[model samples]
Target: MNSIVNKSLRRLYLLGKTVRWGMRPCPAGARETRLIAGAQRSGTNLVMDILERSWEADVYHESDPRAFQVYRMRPLPIIQELRKRSRAKCFILKALCESQDLPELMEQLAPAKAVWVLRNYNDVVNSMVISFPRTHEDLQRIAQDRKLGGWRTEGMSEQTYRLVSGLVKRHGDALTNASASALQWYFRNVLYFEKGFYQHPDIKLLRYEDLVTQPQRTVSGLFEFFGLPYHPWVHGMVFSSSLRKRPAPELLPEVAELCEKLWQRFQELEKPQSI
Candidate 1:
């Protein structure tokens, strides 16, 4: 009877602590007013790095617990704190699309502008497969790291590899399968010519190809879009930055054909007239 009572008391105490922490106000100078969202491996990191170097933009590379907790207390309250901290007009929040808490974040940053970056779907998938292997052995390794049962131990099949491969073969499938991963990239670009929030007037859409092919023009346009002074040095810096390293794999003829088709589709989607 004493043990049961003590357990109940402990639960109550933890609940109270959680509520208290949740209600605490976020510290001054810690919310982001600007944001960058995109699929993984889509140059979001590079863009953030360049923006920080050129514009003196305050960018948080990952989600901050304090900021998140504060955001939970009140939407946009963090923005005020960020403004106070940086004493800059813009604060950039960089987060993986699928991982962000959308409704809450959107509520807080309703009027904020966003930058969405996209890469060819085949490239994105190929990169993921290389970096995050889906083989049973790889899954087992991941599970061990995560303190979960290994795939073999858990009696899970090795079908994850096939499933991931199939999904990557479909263009824009990342946005659909991992919506937050590629949400802004897929959705906003698709609706760029349209009006309203779906089209997001303040959002700027950029392609990884353009960044690679014409760094100067692309960075210049980005700075201008954000109302920041265009720095000549930024062009060179962005170009010289290390590209994401990927092992070269001889593409199957079919995959190569698919990549070409998707690349063409991307070109069609990015025509200036389309926007």
Candidate 2:
């Protein structure tokens, strides 16, 4: 009885908390701002850091609960509220691709610009395999524990082995699979580009590889794109060598091969001829 009551109380508390955060207002002067949406691990965080460091831009990190909640409400209201609160001449919101409702959110913030960043599919998968090995393991373990899923969910002792095998077999895959993950990334980029955001007179597409290979050129282009003053600090903030270093064991050749296939597909998509 006590445990049941505790669970009920916790559920009610969570419900109230969600409602409170969900209904919060956008900051004043933030309407009609720029949005940066892309796949996870695609340098979105790096871009956000650079933008935030700029004195002229009021850049919000993923901290705003309202950013996500606004989509649940009518899009226009959130846009109006955001514009009312943003103090900078331009506001930028960054969200991951899996954040699903971003297309609708972008439409609401229309007349706004966008920067879509992408990395090589293999590199992305390699990064994920390294960054969240436990996630791969958990999925397999859960599947086996539940006894209702496919082979990928079968008994798995180590996450790394499971991920490699899963990727090779392409079985009961989750976000951890390089091909699926890469396809998802490609889809997100395609969705916005197809929506005509790239040619919307305000939007621009950026590649993660370019940002790293030509930091100055990319940053300069972005500054020019937004009509913001270019500063030396922005360059310093753009490329963080420490941030890009891989900390985990290297992914095996089989995993790398899968990622390469995804990368090839992305290449075929033809990035905007010029940002």
Candidate 3:
């Protein structure tokens, strides 16, 4: 029958398309690729700064146009161009990508390294209150585009924006209180990275608090792990009076519980490993 034939043809076409996609050449490179991934405002930039200061490694921040521009383009080309452009013995790209992409990035780049930065949940939530879009309109725009996600606001109520703003007002830029929605978003990104890369041999997890108190030793260890030379760079790094403390946010009961569980899990991962 015409209907049966049409269905068969459509299925066959899809099968052919998949085959072509699979056949596309994977990226090949001798230059090592390292991904710096973590929740937003978790001090990935500071980590990168240390990496840059302590070693001669090439570091790319997320805002750099090169970071994910070619993400949509087919394979090989992406990493190939990255290597050719960076020309560093090893290339570090700061990317907060999905856990789903971990296997492929490893499979395609084969032996790619990753670094994850962790910070206190309360501090992170508080920092986000200062850093993220303060207006309800800006928050709505982000939800629609979800430039970052697991997906954010997927199951949460839209009133989350109002809740966060209210926290800002009560705490007065300290955000000593957090909304459940913000905690959920943080948990998803942090937990996803932990579960995906916890067992991977090439990944390293660093704590912001440690990096704050003891910069030289921590950075030297990271460079040594990456097989790069270590230098005295942290001495030149600037510190703000704000780094020592924030009035820790008073979290809601459920938000606090989820955040505590996340802390416990990350603590286990933060153990000093051989890089």
Candidate 4:
């Protein structure tokens, strides 16, 4: 009950700011959609919550029926209509499932920008095991049945599919749920490279660790990239308690190495490039 009231109060505060800021014309003088994409257990929700506190933005959570149907995005036309109807200058949408199609979606919604959040695989798997107990079984099906089509398999390349299948085959029935969940993380995030996001000017890679440990600077940088005004209160809700809260989930040595390699790649990418 207290949580509900707190959420409502936060909304009221943001709405007041919206009305105050809405009196003036938007700085950009045009609407912009900010797509937040990442694996399910990554820190996408944390970023979304921060942006939702902004006066200039309207948020569409994956559970919002108006923008999503069972976590999959509604049709493009419907999405465009939602953006058109919203009075806020920024339309914030969570598109974790549609992450692989980010490039195409950005082109279709030109003037849109995206941020893909990366969390440590160990932490992500830990959260997934608790939040979605079915993840391991679900991923097992995807590995054994390549024809299974859903958000999990959608946009998955043949190369990645084979890689997952091969990994599962090596472990056979001995694959632990934690390991399966880790593999799920691997294939989903690998698309960041497979889709050529490294060179995509409009897309930014965000590290979950950075956001929690250095919320102010990290979020300020993201706001700058998206051209949204910064608000101190936006990052207030973020807490670092979740970081390494539990011993890293045990996984097969090979799977651990794979996830670690990808994690290091994300860290390297987070560093600023030479001009």
Top model by TM-score, which number? 4
Off by over 4 Å in 3: 1-30, 69-76, 134-177, 180-185, 189-194, 238-244, 269-275
Clashing pairs in 3: 176-249, 176-250
Q: Give lDDT tens digits, candidate 3, residues 65-147.
A: 65554322224567557656654556766665443255556566555777677777777777777666443343334434444
- Which structure is stronger by lDDT: 1 or 2? 2
TM-score against truth, every candidate: 0.53, 0.60, 0.66, 0.93
Tens digit per residue, CA lDDT, model 2, 109-198: 654666667776546655665554454554445444534323222222344344444553454543344444443334444444445544
TM-score computed on alpha carbons, candidate 3: 0.66
What Cα-based lDDT does every candidate model obtain?
0.49, 0.56, 0.57, 0.84
Range of the 10 consecutive residues with the lowest summed lDDT in candidate 1: 175-184
**Which has the higher TM-score value, candidate number 1 or candidate number 3?**
3
Q: Provide the clashing-pair count of each candidate structure.
A: 4, 13, 2, 0
What digit string (tens of lDDT, one per residue) describes model 4 on residues 113-202? 999898999999999889877766776777778766378777788998888888888777778888989998998999888888777888
Candidate 1 per-residue lDDT, tens place, 70-116, comes to 32222357655654555333566764432223334555654355666
Candidate 4 or 1, higher lDDT: 4
> How much is the lDDT of residue 237 in candidate 3?
67
Candidate 1 clashing pairs, residues 3+ apart or interchain: 29-81, 97-180, 98-180, 98-181
Provide the lDDT at 109 for model 2: 64
